[model samples]
Target: MRLIQIINDIRLKRKLSLIFITVAVLPLLISGIYLTNKLREVMVSNAFEQASDNVERVQKRTAEVINVALDISYQLSNDNRMKSIASRSYDSYNEVIQTYRQYTDIRDYVRLYKEIKAIRLYASNPTMLNNWEFMQPDEQTTKEAWYVSALNKKGLAGWGYIQDERDQKHYLSLVRKINLDDLKNESVLVINVNSDLLNSILSQESFATMIVDDSNNIVAANRPDLYGKNLSAVHAESNMLWQSEGSFDAVMNGKNSKVVIANLNPQNSWNGLRIISIFTISDIVHDANAVIRISAFVVGGCLVIAVLLVYASASLITGRLLRLSKHMSQVGTLSWDSYLDLDGKDEIGQLSRQFNALVHRISQLMFEVEESNQQKQLLLQKQNDIKFKMLASQVNPHFLFNTLESIRMEAHLRGEEDLAQAVWQLSILIRNSLEVGSRQIPLSEELNMVRCYLELHKFRFEDRLQYKMEIDPATEGIEIPPLIIQPLVENSILHGLDRKEDPTLITVRTRLNDHGELFVEIQDDGAGIPPKKMKDLTMRLMDSEEPGNRIGLRNVNDRLQLTYGQGARLSIESEEGRGTCITFCIPKKGVEPVVFSDNR
Candidate 1:
């Protein structure tokens, strides 16, 4: 289970490699095993059949040799020289010589037939020559198995093993008893068969061959060591000899073997001879084994090549998927200026093309969002400017200035010069305040308006109000929003000085800093606001949110910020019962010129 999980956790390329190997190699392995088994069976069967055929051929050859030997024995039994010798008709040496000459004819038969080793005549006649061609049976010769067996079955041919007197070599002899009643004597004819004939017949076979007699003794064999041995000792089972034809599997000579048994003419002799063939199983299946090895190599090589091809192809495909995954991971963090360049109609290529389109659409939507936001900011700034202008226009100074002019004229006509001057200052102050058409005006003109207003305030308060203006000459020509400074001064008089018991002093100062920023300050020596109230008003000025009750101060800050962005700002410093100083800084180059409509 752990191995399976590990395989599952493997990458797609490795997984595909495994799948390819299983698909390609599994059938090959099964087929190779099946073919090997079938080939082994077929090869072994063919070896058995071939061995059986070879044994049959050897059986036929041995039968032919036995038949030829039997025919020679029958011919010898009827020979006229042997009949004369059996009749004892030869008395003189001349007659014996003639008979001996005829006996030489039988000896010539042995030389003529290669299967016949020698032919010997064993007679009871006294006149027979005891030479190589003829033998007079002695006590030992007559006691021999072949001699005794032949004499018991008179005139009938029989077969047995014997050792030749001339070479002491073993041979299979065909023995027949010759009975001649006219001569009142008996003779035995022995035809010694050459063992090389049977050996040659068995030796021609490819496998080991043995000719076994009825006694289970091996009469002839391809392996000389097996000759004359009991056949049962070689193969534990002698039942194979009884099987006249066919094959079987058995263990022989410490090896697995196929045994084929055949008989050499069972009907011709009572003592049957069997031809047994033994072939080792390994030798029979040798070719099949070679074929199986070659097939295995070929199949293994094909599997390796197939796996390599699968790995390469799968890697190529999965590599594109991995690259696509990487690109998608970077979608929001980086610019989507480019896309995958895989150019094919495959699924991954299609996915890449679609991803590029998606990124392009996203970029376009983001651009639209940014453009919309910029337009909303501009619209908001315009609305705030319009609101500021409307707030400033709320106090109409034209009518008030005209009324002050009439008051000044009346004071002058009544001969009140001091009151008339005060009324004239009031008229000038009102005129300056009425000039609301210009969003910006020169600082000198605004300062003059401030002076007029202060003079009028001083005239009204008498000894209770005192004020001073310390303005820099360099800042006099600087453009500022109209009515900005006067509001701060008005706020100080209304909120701080109005409740003061002692005489109040208000100071208005303007200067340009080294960094080209204009600083304006309104200071009052009067009752200051509480710490909490001061903090609240400071927050109102600094906050960009809409003003609540402190509209005048917030309006001034808003107008500065709208025109000059964050570069222009208002800051207030105050201490309870000490004084209050409201200061604002405007960058010289930061302010934007404001355009005002004459309709206001």
Candidate 2:
């Protein structure tokens, strides 16, 4: 009740503003917040579900690779030829090589299956020659962990990273004890699984995925650098892999990461492998953040519109009341038909007189303001014209001297026809330069001038200087200040030729950035600016004073800043003895469409 009484005491404008905010803004604000949060939750849930599916897919593929090794092991375990070769003792190396060649099943399996890289049988026969395929185990080989573990497992298969005697490169191999004549640790079959094939399976996965054995040695991984590395060596939060079958959040490689693990238990294997897939949280919900940003922008835009509408409505209501009050106070104050009206210096009468004086003063001010704006416009036009002329004067003398010297040198060396062509091109450049006074031309026309300049230089430099223009077709219709591109191109050629004997390449490229801003770059693969000079030049470009050395460059920078605000200024990137790239960007807001044109 007190709130209602207080509200009633306020003016009608305040009441309307409050009502507008309550009715239009409050509900929208509430719904927008609720929708944003729900959308984020749904996105996160969907990402989790998708990641789970990916893990399952990787598990199936990884199982197939593991099954190949198991199938080969099963087939070889029952083969009589392999059993006989391991059981028999060989007296001579020649006899052993002949016997190995005759028993081709192991070689055939390695050759037939893309999943199998190598197959070796370790026999305990003392007289057997140590052929690579059938190797006699030494004392150290018999005591190794893999060898001892396979012996203890009695014929059950195991997987591990074992060093191959041939290349000495460690590979994920299936190690199993082959029971020959009731001797458990007498013979064994070691089938090295194709590490390339295992890596290929994980390569198809989107996230960083790897296959780790029960021993925590990474057998194969999508990231090649992690192959054969222990789990603890790569990730600090490796303890999560001990859980071995679920998704968990941890820090991997110094980044917050989500890890999903699944076990691959083959048919009769002693130990199964683990499939671990890791992805950063940001990568999983990038699309969600984008959606949230768009939602916030929309909500903020609507709230701004609502506030504006409320202010406008309040101003309209209060203005009407003030006008009504003025008219009411005027009644009985003005008299007609030769009767003298006496006015009191009361509050209402004083307000009426003051209002009239304000009106007269506003009228006079409006007239003076209009006159001042016209003068400013005229002054701006004159300034632009003078600026263009100054920039042109600074460029022509240096350009003409160089161009004429080139033509004279060419005429001396070549035929008169070449000199005529050079002269015609020079005439065209002069005309274009003279006509470019404060007028914006299509980007295509400016690029055409740059091409002409490069062509003339090509005639002078021959193969010493080469240039290419990678111009975006969309930017062709954009209207930009004339002579902006050609001067920069000339600057590149001038510096690019100095202290360089190799073929110099001048690349003039133009494109639009993601924000629809126009970007232009002039690149030169030649001797670059030294760091000290580069620093001095950068500082000089920032000063308001005009530069004496790089006048054309400074002029172009000034004109771009003046026409399109300070965001459009030249940026220099250079490394001494390597190359230099000069780039500039014009903001999207600064690129205005021009309806009128004077070609001259």
Candidate 3:
């Protein structure tokens, strides 16, 4: 009940603002937030789908490569020539030559299959040449993991990745034990598959992909650095191989990533092979985040615009009521004929008409007095105009310029070159100050004035002041507002340099950017303005109504905006105890001179 009473006491405009926000802007904000969240979720889902597809593709290609290796191993195992050579015991040279010819046929098979790296046959027969294609089982060979595993498997083909003894190159080895009953001898045939073939299958995948064996050792990966490393070393979860198909979030190399694991063929000899795809989640959501940011900005902008429109509409509707209320307060002093010209059938309009009717009856008594007061107001306005013109004329630049010229002449006659130079600079300043006919002058003219002012200050400060002017020749012809650069330079000298004990250095620079825009900068190496003070100064520059000082920084800023648009406005950057820099840009195409009423 208390809240209701307070709301009733509030004005109609405030109630309207509340209604507009609740009915329009509130729903918009809610929907915008919902849509943004939904869009992010959709993007994440799409990324997961892409990762899943890549994993599936890698699984298919890896299965094909493994199947090729399996086919090569089966062919080598079933070859009659391989079995015959293992069963026979060569004695004559011609018999050994025939065995060599049969082994050459096996070599032809390795050459036919590009995936086959090399083929090795180890036998108990001492007559066989222990060369590239044949080897005698030594202690090192028997101790190897592949050799032991193959021997345990007996005649069944065993598959594992191992390094070649000759080149130290990795290869997928298919080892099978052969038992020859004719010679009562046993032999081993090893088929080495090129690891590059497996790498080529994974290379086409876009995401970071890897193939790991049953032992979790990485056989092939897109990044060479990860090859031969354990899968558990990259991702903490070593059980990822057990999962047939799934994705989970994990940290890889200290970065947030999504890992997708898919089993290759479960029935094949390479059943333990798993294709893992890992990608940064941030990379997937980057575009979505950009879209959300833009959407948020648009939503916020709409809300602000809605508030402004509501306020304006409410103010328009309530203005008549306020005017009627004011007239009621001054009813005793109002004339009878001074009626409100409001035309509406609304309650406020009816009240205004009624007030006009009541005032008409009281106006006859004060009509003569109102006429006399009107005449007095007209006379006061005329007096104000005369005073304004007189004040404008009193700002005489000619007197100051002539006095400086006289001083310059006297200094020259007395042979005081430095004094005469300072006097000449002061005269230039006075002459430029008097030229109020045009708002814009050549950038060269403005820079020349700044140079003259700084030179005069250099004379006054002596060794305590150092100045540098670096002006691009291309920017000299552009036109800008007069005194725009000078006041900033003056500000640096007065506020920036005054507090420092060491020598102060001021730099004035102008350059043409790639866009053909002229940028002017003024920097000082002195005690800089504080951050809080710099913020206050920036706010003051933005305020147009309050031109506090006659020749102040705000005055220059307002003039720059008036002559050129907001594009050409002053920007202040300062750090305490470091320095200050004031910069502004001017387009190559000059703007027309805008005549301001407050120029005088």
Candidate 4:
């Protein structure tokens, strides 16, 4: 009877202890889930609100700066000074440059840097800035298209860029055209807008903000070195392009961001230029019901009471399990280099000692993984080395032209004047075809190459092939793919000019567009190709079609795609005998002075 009573009482106590532990665990689990969810929701919402608010502030400030640029153009268009320059003619370039020297302060009106981090270049005659032959901008002048556009358009023309002929400083050009009637000349008044003010605006808003003119070339940026790099989202981390042009939220820089795009032109002109503004995520929401974390005596008073009540049965299991979990979390990612540190005397200590031995086994396996990675990297390095060689050996037609140029020079020295001029022009054409190895080159360089080829054809046909270049000088040195213009010219010649009857005319035109691309048109009075054939030829431009032909046109197009990616391409337009006009656009990439890294 005594034994039966003892056993029954012990069983009842055990049952009671289990019930108490279950009740305690239920509350802890419920509280943990609720707290974790509440905290996450509150913090995430706060992050979103902060990003939105900060970008909104940046958007507003950027607008004011943009308006100032627009207003400067507006004010100058209606200025008495511009009217005076238009009405008078100066005898010397100094007189013309001095004519509107007073307007240099226009830079300040544009919110440019106070210390003047930028400068300007100007020409006295309209043709001096226009006529390709007389314009010699080697490294000191920037030819601005807005100068001429302002003359023709009669207002603030450039928020984009003209050629930076003067290599001394980088600037945003503010140009106005004055007819200067007295001298029978057009004087372009150029104001060099310092980049720092724009940079300051970007600095206020983001870690990095870039301003690209329609040609996609970096015009202004918080990081100036990035200027001249392409900003195509499809190709890089450039923010998603604004299709309809408005503000929106996005994921950027490991956090939320607000991107606002305002069309630079009023009346909601989608086709006109626009400005993109960005702001961070932290500035938007305020913290009110933020979830807070509580630590113990993690278990503290309540856990202690529960433990005391159940210690005789559950203490050993709970302690050992908690210790295992703690070591697991700490060992996994927190201390991969030192997960085997074990020194203790209890049950938890014995488990750690076993874990330390297991870790040593894992370490040997990791050593093999590291060895494999080293081998893989070595192979990758070898592959890249080979690609570098291929880049070098890939023949640029310009190499042949340079050889031809040397022959022409020899001919000139020997009094073969006609042959020398002919080869010189041919060399120029070839150079244009091969110039795209660098990140940037003048728009003029591209056109010059075209003109050289045109001149070459003119000689081949004994002047039957007539060609003219109508390039906006301001477009010179604005940067483009090295081979972008040449291929279009080649296509026009092969499919159009080469088979023309009577005297043929080919014209190459270059202009800056709002989408940040150079609209280059190559037109010819020759038979055109069928649409189907044109498309097929285009697709095969980069792929092999002819076994060993250079497929000069195709090769050049492929290169443009590779060099400039999305914003560069080749297309053809033609008719039976009416004429063929080929238009291809190149986005301006900034100057990368050295083409071959020669790192090897």
lDDT of each: 0.76, 0.78, 0.75, 0.58
Off by over 4 Å in 1: 1-36, 86-98, 181-184, 241-246, 266-268, 286-600
Q: Assess candidate 1 and give its TM-score to the true structure.
A: 0.42
* Pairs clashing within candidate 2: none
lDDT of 3 at 433: 74
TM-score, candidate 4, is 0.35
Tens digits of per-residue lDDT, candidate 2, 187-295, equal 8789998999888888887678888888788999988798889887777574555777988888765777777888888887788888888877555665476567767
Comparison by TM-score, 3 against 4, better one = 3
User: How much is the lDDT of residue 68 in candidate 4?
Assistant: 52
Q: Total clashes, candidate 2?
A: 0
- Model 4 lDDT at residue 213: 60
Model 2 quality (TM-score)? 0.44
What is candidate 4's lDDT per residue for 495-525, written digit by digit as tens?
7766766777788887777765667788888
Error of 4 at 224 (Å): 7.0
Off by over 4 Å in 2: 1-40, 182-185, 253-255, 286-600
| Per-model TM values vs. the true structure | 0.42, 0.44, 0.41, 0.35
